[model samples]
Target: MLFRVDVAAAEPLADQIAAQVRGGILRGDLAPGERLPAARELADVLDVNLHTVLRAYAKLRDEELIELRRGRGAVIRADADAARLRLVELARQFVGEARRQGLADAEMLAIVREAQP
Candidate 1:
């Protein structure tokens, strides 16, 4: 697969990787069930860290755009509806996990409240 990384971009490397893969998925450049290059491979190509690739994969997985499996690596998810549902479930889990880490509902509420224009 032909992929290039822009180290000069303002966004985080993980976010940049996620945006490209997500756009490719939406534009049909990468089809459902297609296998993405392994994180290590992509990292080497991008001259970034393996953990950066993993972070990108994790973001795409959170977006329901990809499925990461042991040994099998990451693959695009085919079912759009299922992906949406999966994102919802992941959001719930993330919020729950954050709460467990001492980020209470009130603190979250305060952040949201402060974000308004």
Candidate 2:
């Protein structure tokens, strides 16, 4: 998967890396069982610290979007598709509920923003 980092962005490098990988999986650019680049290699490519890449990998693994195994590297989880589909379904339901409640898109999004940590 192609990864890029905005060095000048406000977001942390690790978070940026994790977000890109997550986006790739959700958008079908990265397939289930596809192995990601080794942390060191990705860190080199992105010109970031090795630990930053590893931290990003850990976040993905913790979210169950990917799996990390000894001698196996990091691979996208087989169930990621199901998880992504469920999230999409949930979002659709949320939008429907918001519409039924007469909430405008901006208002609904504002509520979401307020609820976010």
Local distance difference test, each candidate: 0.79, 0.86
Query: What TM-score against the true fold does each predicted structure earn?
Result: 0.66, 0.71
For model 1, which pairs clash?
Answer: none
In candidate 1, where is summed lDDT lowest over 10 consecutive residues?
A: 80-89
Give the Cα error of residue 47 in candidate 1, in Å.
0.6
lDDT of 1 by residue, 2-117 (tens): 56678888778998787678657645678888999999998987899999999999988987778999999999888635445445556566686778788988887786578688
Candidate 2 on 1-117: residue-level lDDT in tens? 678899999889998998888778867889999999989889887889999999999988988889999989999999887466558657867997999899998999998899888
lDDT top scorer = 2
